[model samples]
Target: MKRLIGAGLAVVLVPVLLLSMLVAVLFGSEDEAQAAPPGGQPGVVCTTAPASGSGGSAGSTTGQDVAGFSGDQLDNAAVIVGQGKALGVPERGWVVAVATAMQESTLRTLNYGDTMANGQMSSSRGLFQQLDAWGPLADRLDPAKSAAMFYTGGQAGQPGLLDIPGWEQLPVTVAAQRVQQSETPDAYAKWEQPANQVVGAVEGRTCTTTPAAGAAGGTSISLPSNPRAETVINRALSQLGVTYSWGGGDANGPTLGIHDGGVADAHGDYAKVGFDCSGLALYAYAGIGVAVPHQTQAIWAAFPHLTDRTTLQPGDLLLYSSNGAANGIHHVGIYLGDDRMVEAPQSGDVVKISSGIWGGNRGAEFIGAVRPGA
Candidate 1:
């Protein structure tokens, strides 16, 4: 019999776009989830991994045949799901975790760091983008090893994350920081609730935060006033066919468009309207007051841990590999179910919705979707 991993979850709202453009957009140079390694005090290390194979899992039931996600995304999802099951994390948590990853490093373990210099890039190390400056490599490339480090800090003092303040009711960012010690703790707080909501819907499960037994109480991370509003998405849609620019969106930076898609002239700051990969992501979410980081790598750093891609939903990000590196996913977009996505296409292409995989373009590729406000 197929085991019901974590908790059975429900499906979330999925989007449907007509033309989708997913090229190298919003690509950032940084390592996300930089945390202290394990070997500290021992906590509740749930030895049993959660059971991922559901009897009849819902949502994107098409399995590997789904046209949206690429082979890499599917493979990554399978691995992540297996990992979540091994850890016995609720299915909802697993899905939300993947969404968090989507918002972060696009699920590609990083081998470099942010900040390019003198026409040279730094060769940092590890999964979830760890910097070598922190220390030498100690099982850095291994996702499990990195995950262990992340959990060591993220799950410190709390069994099943019960000790973290507002974790259960917060966004993926908040819940993530509870486990992952980050420079910007507040940043992760915002993604907590959305991540949970997305995970719950994808896994067909329900998570609660009423407190277990004698657990202390904390304030829930309040969600945006209207999560379902199409203001941001709509604005992004309106600004299709924009050119790409690098370093367009940083935290509290200019407001033209910093991500990949959309159309804009090149100039200093917000003089014109252009965006790179991360720029577009920030612009779209900013329409709704989300205030996402300008750097794509920072997005990964400031959120909960993510798992597989089968748990993706609309408004979620779909990051894919531009170059065929083992785990090098360089492109990103907003997921619109049925293998469709809404994003700013590459040069010569307008902002439009298209197939997640084949948006009628030779270079168009589909990776995995990241649920930001899941």
Candidate 2:
């Protein structure tokens, strides 16, 4: 009788246990799903010595070694870099000045711009293409004086890097944008790569920011141990300071203008933009052969759930949602290790790195992470 009772109890409990497990699988708790991803050895190992002798000492008059540039162009580039040093700007500042000059005037010290519709001069000139408001006409035309004005504001109170608080922490393009206030703010970003090369050649040493030779399109600093992860992170980093426009980027690249008028218009960002949050992730992952949807919710659904956040690798994504619902997912950022993340924040912002991904209300509720192509 005792043995028969025990057998009956076991038989009853087994089916209940099985059913409970099925329910758990079908409707797991948010805590269970949100468990942090595992952490371990870095997926990619990057080993490259840092470059030497960034910007030279002030007033050193050191000769530069610029290759593939005409004598006049090289001379002007040196003047720009030298003036940056004289103004106490760092090597990164030198790169920004040179790159800005390259885009504005090709270091040619232009004396004028196309006549306006009103038949008046555009009043833009010099390596930086300063307007007459930048300084007296003669000062705008003088290379050394103009470069100085570029780094340190001229008599007209035009803001320079020194004038902008925390300019050093901003990306090269952003720092330049703060000073130039160009109509096309993103144009300066294109010159960063070439500018790095020019600075490296001039300094007779590799620039710390120089991307590795043959790096996918020569746009990345170093490749990681995981080739795909390397491509994703590098491609994303290459877009630092790119404008955040709603529906502005796709797998291919940045689109011409803002395509979505709903949320983007609400944010007052209707101009041509670079990338939004999900769009940046989409493009970055696509570079590594991973297809991520442009919408945040779809991107979250596409990747396999990482059970442990600590295990998140470099290219993994940290997604955010307001209510933990499928449609609630609204933001995404790529993890860069050491608690850093790269993101194309909301309107009026640019692609940049932030210290923590979960500090703000938008990221308050942990929605777990996903590793694409892992």
Candidate 3:
């Protein structure tokens, strides 16, 4: 009896020790891990901006009156101009509007749900998200007008502007909060540096007050720099009539969304393996110098502007509605021009290029156009 009891205690005690060890491993402190560099690699600044370009002289800036921002803030005014111009806003007004948008939205046209209550999110939309219900509003839903109005008329003395003190004289962030009445007033300030850099690169300007390049002479609606953009478009076109897969947008992906890295299988045709919406863009731009993100929201956030479908160009990204009944981006494709696009299609299909079709219907929601290399 004594021997049997001792053996039973050993079995229970051994498992208890192992279980404690497992718990220790599983619940180990994460602070040390966070302190370590990502992927166990050190010396990487995860948030560094891309290198600037040698893209020539940015002209003078003439826009709404802004006084409080530091002179250095104007460095990226050109990128803001190029970005705003893409959105169809005038250059002078573009600077002011961009400053405001950088203040309000950080130049990103987000689709995520906002904290603002009421229908401001529903009726008012895009980068500015201005509401039509607001008195004397210009197509408030339009990013251009909304940005302009927000910039030009944002005043602290105004009733709604009271939330932001000294808004008119404050930096873009303060002014934007006054106009937007956002719960978080300081959010827009984070974009100041990046917004300025992008604007300066695209517009070729040193400051918001500089004379802008002949507005019409700058930025033609032309092809971006992805050298392989044309090649991939051609390759995808060669695979027309392939069936669609759920996650099957790349060459190496299985069916759809089946492959790792979200790349579709190459389907073993031209050895043209692994290309999803981002993959296609990546390969295309790799031919040039730029690299795009893989995910849809990241791609949208990285791009310059939301362009109209009528002005679609080769290598432009085409997004389709996903939210059952013509809303929310569920799929994406590459525009090959001439109303033709290259896409993975849907489930039961291999990676192939064909006339665009979204959910068995030709009238897929045209989310917007993106110029891959500007």
Candidate 4:
């Protein structure tokens, strides 16, 4: 929910060329009977490891297909929902929590710190992207603990889900907003439909539903389906833990960092060896004999897009905007599957795996993903 805010912040809104993508089997038939939530009935650690069914659960960890999420992604949601249930955050809070997670980290566990638009490093992390003031990094990253923190309160005793005044009366998005107070007040609304779909999925039930009329979608993306995607992802992952030196990478390897004269200079990135966001991407695709440039937008424009952006696969590049504007694509990352990505997040940071999605900052939404190369 937080990220670097550099200067030169000119933003232009574009039509939200949003794409709604979900695996249909993840949301069963309308007649499918409702089953209890994961954990076999809403207890602590209500997590499930996916059954080794051959046909395709899309790496689902809950043993059942869940829309837009699988593996640890779905597990994170179960933790959120189950924790909310344990705390008795009202059934509404469960949906609100799921929706909120959808808004914050796309139900993935984010480990990277973000810098705000004002160019300040924000130590926000975890499923909900709680700030450093929330708790320790470990606590923030723990699904159950983070969910508990969201339900219980922040370190400053800020209200959690149940503490909000008249929270139950609020609509799903409204209830989520009360807890999040995000800059994008209405962003959570888009996920409301999917959130219910997720809760129903976890509970072993689903309802007949229709898309909310006028529902805006986020930028769509796809992970690598390219035959050489493995080479790209492995190349990127190989550089994990390298410092995020601005302008400091190439198709060959890490190079002397360059100074951006701002945050990059402040971080002494010029003296370091590493890769910036686009540089890392450039280096990654190079492993596949792709010579994309080191600029995020340039790389974005270098390749033709895949026909579909529905399923996020490993090695797809996720884009970000400082102001949530579609035209403000400022950053990029290599998707690493299971709602995780490897990125060189900011000047003082390191290239590492983060909970794969950005909720946008200063008002924009995460441009979803469409794989750039065929």
* Candidate order (lDDT): 2, 4, 1, 3
Of 3 and 4, the candidate ranking higher by lDDT: 4
lDDT values, one for every candidate: 0.40, 0.61, 0.38, 0.59
Q: Candidate 4, residues 91-148: lDDT per residue as tens digits?
A: 5567778777776777778776566678866688888888888888999999899899
Q: Answer with 2 or 3, whichever has the higher lDDT.
A: 2
List CA RMSD, all candidates. Answer: 21.0, 19.0, 26.6, 17.8
- Tens-place lDDT per residue, model 3, 218-244, is 111111333244344433332233333
lDDT of 2: 0.61
For model 3, state the Cα shift of residue 329 in Å: 1.9
Q: What's the TM-score of every candidate structure?
A: 0.33, 0.61, 0.30, 0.41
What residue runs in model 4 are displaced by over 4 Å at the alpha carbon? 1-65, 208-374
Kindly state the number of residue pairs that clash in model 3: 40
Q: Candidate 2 on 1-374: residue-level lDDT in tens?
A: 00001111111100000000000010111211111222211011112332243243222223442333445666777788778767887776787888788777776777776466698667787778788788988898899999999888867788877887756545555567778877656566556656665665455445435321111111232333345655676677666556677877777555434646576777755554468888889888887688888888888888777647666655678888789766787888887655657788788777766665557774466587787777
Positional deviation of residue 131's Cα in model 3 after best superposition, in angstroms: 68
lDDT of 2 at 110: 73
TM-score of 3: 0.30
Which of the two candidates, 2 or 4, achieves a greater lDDT against the reference? 2
Off by over 4 Å in 1: 1-68, 116-124, 132-138, 154-166, 177-374
Give the number of the best model, judged by TM-score. Answer: 2
